[model samples]
Target chain A: AQRVTQPEKLLSVFKGAPVELKCNYSYSGSPELFWYVQYSRQRLQLLLRHISRESIKGFTADLNKGETSFHLKKPFAQEEDSAMYYCALLVPGNQFYFGTGTSLTVIP
Target chain B: DVKVTQSLRYLVKRTGEKVFLECVQDMDHENMFWYRQDPGLGLRLIYFSYDVKMKEKGDIPEGYSVSREKKERFSLILESASTNQTSMYLCASSSQPRGLKLFFGSGTQLSVL
Candidate 1:
C-alpha cells in the first residue's frame, strides 16, 4: 500500500530561522511527490512538485529516492510562511495519498 | 484561472437528515474529487469521478455516495447525516496530463447536530 507520512503534527520556529517540513513515503514504484499548503482562512493550494524542480515562494523540495523522502526546505522562515502543509503521493490510477499534515508557526 | 466551486461555505444540519454537497468546475477538467478534511486526519478522499457518470470509491467512502451526471459537476451525498459526519468538505478538479495539479475550492464546513 502506498502511504505518505508527515511526522510532526506541530512545529514552531523563529523568523529568519531555517525551516524544514519532513515528508516520507512508502511506495515501491517511481513516485510523484507534491507539497500542498493551506493558510488560515484560505483554500488549500499546491506549493510545489518534485517534477517541476522549481522553487516557489523561496521554498524548495528535493526528492530523495534512496531515503523515500521529499522534505520541504526554506532557508529563512517568514512569518507569512506559517501554515498547514501536507505531503501527497500520486499513485498510478489517479489516487492521491495525503499525509496527516504539519502545522508550522513562525514566531516573530 | 481554474475555478472549482462548492455550493455552500457553511451548513448546519440535524442527524438523520439527508445532505447534498455540490461541486462544479469551470476548467472542463476530466477529473473531479471529493475529500473531507479533519484536524489530525488531514485530507481523506471520499470519492472521485474521472468522467461523467463514472465514480470511484476513495480512501474513505463509508457514509457517503456520489453522483456525476455532468462532466463538470460532482455531487457528494450523505444518506443520513450523523454527528460524526461533520467535517470540512473540499472539492477539486484536474485535467489529464496535468492531473497532478489540483485546483481546490474554499471548502464547505458542515456540522451535523
Candidate 2:
C-alpha cells in the first residue's frame, strides 16, 4: 500500500536557524509529491509540488527517488513559518495519501 | 483562483442526531473530496465524487456517506452523529488533469455532545 510518512509531530526552531521537515513515502513506482500547509486560522493550501521544481516562500523540496523522500527545507527559518505542514503522495488513481503532519514552531 | 466553500464553520449537535455538511466548488472541477482532520491521524479521506451522482468510498467510510447530485456540490452525511464523529471536516476540489493539486475550503469543526 502507498503511504506518506512524516515522522515528527512537533518541531521547534529558533529564528534564522535552518529548518527541515522530513517526508518519506513507500511506493514502488514513480511518485508525484507535494507539500501542503495550514497556518493559524487559515485554510489549508498547497505549498509546492516536486514537479514544479520551484520554491515557495523560501522553502524548497527535492524529490529523492533513491531514498523515497521529499523533505522540505528552508535555509533560514522565520517566525511566520510556524504552521502545520503535510507531505502528500499522489498515486496513479488520482488519490492522495497525506502524512500525519508536523507542527512547526519558530521561536523568537 | 478556485474557491471551495463549505456551508458551516462550526457546529454542535447531540449524539444520534443526523448531520449534513455541504460543500460547493466554483471552479467546475471534476473531483471533490471530503476528509476529516484529527490530531495524530492527519487527514483521512471520508468520501469523494468524480462526477455527478458518482461517489466512491475513501479510506475511512464506515461512519459516513456522501451525495453528489450536482456536478459542483458534494454533501457528506452522518447517519447518526456520535462523539467519535466530532472532528474537523474539510472539503476540497481539483480538476481532472491536475487532480492532485487540491483547493481547500475553511474546515467545519463539528462537535457531537
Candidate 3:
C-alpha cells in the first residue's frame, strides 16, 4: 500500500531557529514528493514539489530516495511561517497520498 | 495564476437534505478533485474527475457522489446530508498527472445541522 507518514503532529521553535519537518513514504514506484502549507483561516497551497527543484518562501525539501524520506527544511524559522505543513507523495501514474500533517509554530 | 474556485464559502443544511457543492477551475485543467478536511485527517479525497462525464471513487466515497458535466466544472453531491459530513470541503485542480501542482480553493465550510 502507498502511504505518506509525517511523524510530528506539532513542532515549535524560536525565531531564527532552524526547522525540519520529517516525512517518509512507502511505495514501489518513483517518488514525486511535495510540501503543502495552510495558514490560519486560509486555503491550503502548494509550497514546493521535488520535481521543480525550487525553493518557496525560504523552504526547501530534498528527496532522499535511499531512506525513502522527503524532509522539509528551513535554515531559520520565522513567526509568519507558522502553519500546518503536509507532506505528500505521488507515485508514477497515481493519486497523491498525504500524511496526517504537522503544525509548526515559530515563536518570537 | 492557476485558480480553483469553490462556489460556496459557507453553507448550512439539515439532515437528509440533498447538498450540492460546485467547483470551477479557470485554467481548463484535465483533472479536478474533491476532498474533505478534518482536524487530524489532513485531507481525504472524496472523488475525482479526469474528464467530462468521467469520475472515479477516491479513498472515501460512501454517502457521497459527484458529477462533471463540463471540462471546467466538478460538482460534489451529498445524497443525504448528515451531521458527520459537516466539514471543510476543498476543491482542487491540477494541470496533469505527473509533476503538477494541485491548486486548491478557499474551501466551503458546510455545517450540517
Candidate 4:
C-alpha cells in the first residue's frame, strides 16, 4: 500500500526560527513527492516537487530515499508562512496519496 | 496561468438528493481529479479522469462517480447525497501522467441536510 504520513498535526515556531515539517512515505514503486500549502481563505497550491529540487518562499524539501522521507524545511520561519502544509505522493499512474497535513503557526 | 474552476462555491442539498459538482479547466490538461477535504483528512481522492470519456475510481469512489465528456470539463456526481458526503470538494488538474504540479480550484463547500 502506498501512503503519506505527516506526523505533526500542528507545529508552532517563533519568527526567525528554523522550521521543519516532517513527511514520510511508504511506497513500493518510485515515489514522486510534492509539497502543497493552503493559506487561509486561499486555494491549495503546489509548493514544490522533489524532482525540481527548487525552493519556494525560502522553503526547501529534501528527499531522503534511504529513510523514505521528504521533509520540508525553512531556515527562518515567517508569520506569513503559517498555513496548512500537505505532503503528497504520486504513484505510477497520476494517482496521488496525501497525508493528514501539518498546520504550521509562526509566531511573531 | 493554468486555471481550474469549480462552478459552485457553496451548495446545500437534502439527503438522498443527486448532486452534481462541475469543474472546468482552461489549461487543456490531460488529467483532472476530484478530492474531498476534511478537517483531519487532508485530501481524499474521490475520482479522476485521464482524458475525454475516460474515468477511473480513486481511493474513495463509493457513492461518487465522474464524467468527462470533453477535454476541459470534468464533473463529479453523487448518486445519493448523505450527511457524511458533505465536505469541501476540490477540483484539480495536472499536465499528464507525470502529475508534477497540480492546479486546484477554490473548492465547493457542500452541505447535505
- Candidate 4 chain A has its poorest 10 consecutive residues by lDDT at A89-98
Model 3: CA > 4 A from native = B97-99
Candidate structures ordered by DockQ, highest first: 4, 1, 2, 3
**Clash pairs detected, candidate 4:** none
lDDT of 1 by residue, B1-113 (tens): 99999979999999999999999999999999999999999999999999999999998899999999999899999999999999999999989855998899999999999
Candidate 1, residue B20: how far the Cα is off, in Å = 0.3
DockQ of each: 0.82, 0.80, 0.67, 0.85
lDDT of 2 by residue, A1-108 (tens): 439999999999999999999999998898999999999999999999999999999999999999999999999999999999999998876778899999999999
lDDT tens readout by residue for model 3, B1-113? 98889878999999999999999999989888898988788788899888899999999999999999999999999999999999999999886645368889999999999
What's model 2's lDDT at A58?
100
Question: Stretches of candidate 4 above 4 Å error?
Answer: none
For all candidates in order, the CA lDDT equals 0.95, 0.94, 0.90, 0.94
Docking class of 3: medium
**Model 4: per-residue Cα lDDT at residue B1:** 96
Candidate 3 similarity to native, TM-score: 0.95
What would the DockQ be for model 1?
Answer: 0.82
Model 4 chain B weakest 10-residue run by lDDT? B94-103
